[model samples]
Structures are given as structure tokens and as C-alpha cells.
Target: MRDTSTSEIENLIALMAKLPGLGPRSARRAVLHLIRKRALLLTPLADSITEVAATARECLNCGNIGTNDICPICEDNERANGELCVVEDVSDLWAMERAGVFKGRYHVLGGTLSALDAVGPDDLRIPRLLDRVPAEAVTEVILALNATIDGQTTAHYIADQLSGQVRLTSLAQGVPIGGELDYLDEGTISAALRARKEI
Candidate 1:
């Protein structure tokens, strides 16, 4: 016969394993740690996760995830620097925010255009980004996309659309081959942003 409490802990481990970068071993270790430090970590983490699950939403204008229709970044008037940084997803946007380099606005594109996957301009937030350019008085569009082929293809397509509309640029060297922006360190991201080259 199975112990119900043990099964419950195993279920928690299974759920944690589904998260990115966590394997069965790591999940088991994490679950043990959480159980041991329930008051210090597990309880607060569970509460926070519940709160985010209930309140997390996407910003209508930029596709940024937040607790409101308009994210705090979008609502901040000072971030209207006429420079919009375009990223592949909310994770990349958060990475940029963590770096704390660019003081401009952001436009989360959701994901890159993938021909093989049948993803197109309409699939992402490209159209909304286009609308934002002129409406927000944007003078520059920084393609802070990943170093992957799909990311570059999407960036080029966006650059073509906004060629005459605004200045176009992409992160310079330092980003490794096929690297996702979400995995890069803060200093690396800051360097890339500062050394950005026109695309």
C-alpha cells in the first residue's frame, strides 16, 4: 500500500519537474529543500505563485506580462524615450529590465516568426508594434532579439517594415551563437545594448 502523504510529495516533485531546466533529480532535491524550509521558502513561494496565477495578465499594448491591462512600464511616462526595444517574449523583456541599462520602452513580440512552424507577422505582436512606432513618437527600434536564425529572420522582417519609419539597430557581438536573451547575464546584456550596431 502507498502512503498518501508520500504520494502527495511525489506529485509535487512531478509538477516541479515540468518547469524549464528542472529535471527529476533537481525536482526531487528542490521538493526536499522546500519541505525542509517550508516557512522560509515553500509557504511564501506557494502564496506568491497563487497570487501571480490569479492576477498575471498581458499588457494590451506591448504584450508584456503584468498584473494589469497596461503594465507599469507602459504606464510610466518617463519611459517614453522615443526608443522602443523589441524582444521575443516577456522573459527577454524581464531580462532587459534586470540589466537596468536602457531607460526606453519595450515591445514584447511574444515569439519569433517561424516559417517551418507556419508562424507569421499576424501570429505575433508585429502589427501592434508598427502602430506604436508613430503613435508613441518612436525615433528608434532596438532589435534586442536572440541570436538564433528565427530571431534574426523576425528582426529583419520588422526592420523592413519600419525602414523609413525609424532608425533600426540590433545587439552587437558578445552574444553567443544560438543563445537566447533570457539566459544571458546582466553585464552581457548591458554590453550588447551599449554596443548595438545598426541593422
Candidate 2:
């Protein structure tokens, strides 16, 4: 019969290699360390992973990842401040939260409208956003999308659609050109949010 232990180790390494920022070599080292610490680390890590996998879900209202259909932020009535921050991804929303500057609600677009990739408005939750503005009594929409070409294009399109219905604003020039909100530090994000201007 084939040796099962080596095959299991290989499988573990392969799975670990698929994680972001981890390659085959790092995966190998990680697997080895986990094996060495089976009781202290591996068992606990596996249990935590299983629990999170079983409970994790996307928020239906804002697209935030959490342990329930609606994330805590979305369910919290205190966050409904008549303002919504439009972001390109959940990571950007998290970054804004980390900065703790914006107390309003959020809308995650999932991605920008990209002509090269053929991504369109219908593909990025734009219609859902439009529906939410009136439904939620949103008075202002702050475009916190990345500064990429597609990001700018998506922002302009949203602004045009919502013009005269509500106030539209975008992060100021302090956000470096082409800088994704996920990459910026909390302080920089706070500064950008504070300096936001009319789009």
C-alpha cells in the first residue's frame, strides 16, 4: 500500500501554497512547523478555520464579510447617517473603518467598470447602489474608489446618475494617483476623507 503520511503532508503543503503571499517553499516550512506543533498550534488553528468556514458569510446589504448574512455594521441602526461611502471593494471599506473617520454606511461595488476587462455597471452592483440611495434616505455619497482609470470612470458614471438627487463627493488629491485605498495607511485615509471635495 502507498504511504499515507507523506501523501497527507504533500496535500497540506499544496493547500497552504494556495494562500496569498505563500508559495511552495513557505508552505513547506509552515506545514513542517505546524506538524511540529500539532497540539499547541495545528489543532487550534484547524478548529478555528473550521468554525470560521462554517459561519462566515457576506452581508446582503453592504457586501461585508462576517459570520452572518448581514454584517454587524450593516445591522447597526446607529450607522445610518444619511451618508453612504461608495468603495470598490470590501478591503477598502475595512481600511476606512480602520481609519475610523467615516461614521456613515458603505456600499461595496465589488469592482470598477473596466472597458479592457469588459466589466460593466450591471456587473458591479451599480443598480443595487442606485436602489439603496433612495431606500436608505442617503443624502450624500462619498466616492472612495481607487484612483485607477476604471475607478474614476465608475465614479463619474455614478455621479452622473445620482446628480441633483443627492450630494456627490470624492476623495481629494491627497490620495496619490492610482493608489488603492487598501494600500494606504490609516492616517492617510483619514486625511483623504477629511479633505474630500465635490466631484
Candidate 3:
């Protein structure tokens, strides 16, 4: 059977496939769906994407993506509680914000320390974080990095750098709230045991 998809449609599918968690098959299905709902979905989505592409920029203070120089979180004076949460990426910062628990400001590292990838402190926003500590009068820093080896390494590097300056803490690692012990890996079990708190 001769190929029937136009070059433009194929290009759109290819672009969509490049997005995280999307494969060629999924992108194809999504493209078909969008085509069917052109008036309701495709045109609006295209306009939104174009707008965001034109206006989106990284926050100068914390590296969060926003339309302005500084993000709303950074601009909010109420969030300046002298407690800074350091995360590996804007996505992690957003996750913390969704929880609505931490009222302090954030510092996005952009990425973790990866020796394998030759990503060092200078490559990330470590210098900016260090600057923010004293400039913002931060009293505590919560390291909310992932449990990956690189993330832990980055957390340690930041901790060492900020030692004797402020209180430092890290997110506890363990089995999830509803995770079954039998289904968990040994590493998770060990971490859970080590991070156990008084009931």
C-alpha cells in the first residue's frame, strides 16, 4: 500500500512523538484525534502552543519557566519565609507547589550533578543558590532532590557548600504511603527502615 499521510501531517506526528512519554503510535493516534476535533482542540492547542513559545522564559531568580523575568512564586513576598527548598528541576518545584505544604521560596538547580555526564556545580544553578542563601536570609534549606545517585550526590555537594551557614535537610526516602512491602525492592525497604519515625 502506498503511503497516504501528507508530509505536513507526518511532520506533526514526528514532532509530537519527540515529546516525553509519547511514541510514534501514540502520536499518530493523538494526531488523528486532533484532526477529528480540529475546531475544538487542534486550533486552540496550536494557538496556545504558539503563544507559550513566544512568551515563555526562564525565571531569572529560580530558573522556573514563566512569561516574566521572575516567576509568581519568586515575586510573592509572603513566600519569603527564610526557608528555601532546593530542587533539581522546575518540574520538581512545581510538584512541591502542587502539594501546597511548603510556603517557602524555591531554588531550581536545573539538573543534578552527574560525573558520567560531566555536569558539575558550575553547570547547574549552585552558585545562584549559594548567593540566594545569604541575600534572602535563608534559615533552612530543604534538599528535595530525587533518590537517584546523581541527585543524592548533588544534594551532598550543596549541603557541604552550605554547611555552617544554615540548617540543612533532605526529603526522606522510603516505600510510598500505600506501597506494599512485598512488592518493594530491597533498597526501598532498607531506606524505609532507616527513615522510620516515632509513631
Number of the top TM-score candidate: 3
Give the alpha carbon lDDT tens digit for every residue of 71-132 in model 2: 88889899999989999999999999998989999999999998999998999889989999
Cα lDDT computed for each candidate against the true fold: 0.94, 0.91, 0.94
Runs off by more than 4 Å, candidate 2: 1-3, 175-199
Higher-scoring candidate on TM-score, 1 or 3:
3
Question: Model 2 misses residue 10 by how many Å?
Answer: 0.9
TM-score of 3: 0.93
Q: For each candidate, what TM-score against the reference? A: 0.83, 0.85, 0.93
Worst 10 residues of 1 by lDDT: 170-179
Expressed as tens digits, the lDDT of each residue in 91-143 for candidate 1 is 99999999899999999999999999999999999999999999999999999
Across residues 1-199, which tens digit of lDDT does each residue of candidate 3 receive?
2366488899999999999999999999999999999999999999999999999999999999999999998999999999999999988998998999999999999999998999989999999999999999999999999988999999999999999999999987888889999999999999899988999
Ranking by TM-score, best first? 3, 2, 1
lDDT of 3 at 121: 90
Report how far residue 101 has shifted in candidate 1, in Å: 1.6
